[model samples]
Target: MAERKATNKYYPPEWNPKDGSINKFVGQHPLRDRARKLDQGILIVRFEMPYNVYCDTCKNHIAKGRRYNAEKKSIGKYFTTTIWSFSMKCHHCSARIEVQTDPQNRDYALSKGIHRVLAEETKNDTVTSTYSMTGDEKQDEMRNDPFKRLEHLQEDKEFADEEKVHLIDLLEFRDRLASADYQNNSALRKSFRVILGLLLQNFCKD
Candidate 1:
């Protein structure tokens, strides 16, 4: 006699679809502890290239406004608290840099880079008049600015040629803003929209 085609004829009713497989569902994952792959135990974290920092090895610029691969490592623990440090490598020179969270001062300190660049902190904001986004929400807005690739203030031949950004603030504001000093000592005299435009400019440093 011809053998009957093999099939799941003897499969358990629970293993067959529409045969009450839903009740037998087990919440198991194909992968284990996926968050641990990110770093430590945090599933999500943020790291920024804060300044137009120069690579020590190649003297190339690792400019601000871009995200890089970062590793977070715990240095110590105070009772139940832990100190974390964010480590980054210069894409150009492979020079390593670090910034650490200082819970005592409630600030961050960079161990290996010249200075930090203050970046825009805006977005397709809704309900600004009635309710404002705060903290991480506000920050997320700026980081995702839609016009960051548009014209840049740093591209102004007048300003780019004369001014330099420094640790505390602009290094040569006297010269950089001299032309606009009469306009209330402002380096920029444009409208609020223009101000927003200036803040989001992506000045590529290559």
Candidate 2:
């Protein structure tokens, strides 16, 4: 029964050893149902959401890492790399969503039926609760208040001057350490150690 089951694959009347592989003779793809649209150059695949997106038709939120059965096909090529497209349906509203590979940017782009959720939208509000001013807030304050902008400019100038002084001090310290006399002393000490070790070995042998 096992042997019969193993050999249960159907073969058409024209099928023969000389005709080629069994899949070619049977007019079926090796991937079976996954290649149902092989004639159209598309294949069924399991695709995961690359990032958060909102369904345009139903306004439903699709989180990143969500998996779906998608249709995949090579749409074009960027140099030697082929760009692929994935088309899937949203679980909540059954709305279609299409995403394509952006080979140049090394990311995915939404082709249709969906909108991406921005990083700022997904960020927690509590993250900015601290009193320290962020770059954006500082820039906004500087733009609105001339006095604040002038103060910031003065602070920047002071900081740059301090950095320059520190850099000059470091260069002086480096120059002192790398002096010709220092290099000669270092080499002399290294040779003295080698000579002392050889003398100690001879004394021990004697």
Candidate 3:
């Protein structure tokens, strides 16, 4: 883990000044609790310990007195987009720790080990969905069934070739999720969750 410097000397090409505005999407919903649990592994409480501080290198005790700056940034490549906080400067040492926080509740600390847990859950979801697709044999059978085949063909004809390609791209995203090694990567896991959520939301709407 890199040290969280108070000043960001350089911005990566992918960084966007406008990306911060996306945090407004968080809102109250029946699904919000479930989503938070899926991402963080516990039901988030409103009134709890606000911020936790730790030495980044040794993971030792650090003074809780000093306040560090909180920056919201988008991370992960594919299936996730986490707007998480980066805490800098341990009072005990010059170490910096990066922590995950709920965008809705900026002060609360998500459980320490929730990232890998969520990643595993996401992997299982992808595997289950893929397995349900039933391989080429079932697809062939579906093609042979008169009514089902008509419906399938009708849907294909209704969508342009580019739209069909986009659908394939979406399924490929599932493949990416299934293939990822989430054990060592909390950030990747977060990104995957966000991507999966966005893809599913778009798919359901379509």
Best by lDDT: 2
lDDT-wise, the better of 2 and 3 is 2
| Candidate 1 residue lDDT tens string, 107-165 | 56567643443334212212456433345654455468745323333345545555444
The lDDT for every candidate, in the order shown, is 0.56, 0.86, 0.50
Q: Which lDDT tens digits does candidate 2 get at residues 1-206?
A: 88988886766777797988898777777898999987898999999998788999999899989999999999999999999999999999898899999876556888999877875643232245534545666788999999999999998899899999999999998888777777879899999999999999999999
Instruction: Please tell me which predicted candidate would have the highest TM-score against the true structure.
Output: 2
Instruction: Quote the lDDT for 167 in model 3.
Output: 87
What is candidate 1's local distance difference test score? 0.56
Report the C-alpha displacement of residue 117, candidate 3, in angstroms.
Answer: 21
Give residue 155's error in model 2 in angstroms: 32
Lowest summed lDDT across 10 adjacent residues in model 2 is found at 122-131
Give the residue spans of candidate 3 off by over 4 A. 1-49, 56-60, 63-65, 76-82, 103-206
Report how far off residue 78 is in candidate 3 (Å): 14
The TM-score values for the models, in the order shown, are 0.33, 0.48, 0.22
Which is the better candidate, 1 or 3, if ranked by lDDT? 1
67: Cα error in model 3, Å:
0.5
Top-down lDDT ranking: 2, 1, 3
Model 2 root-mean-square deviation = 14.8
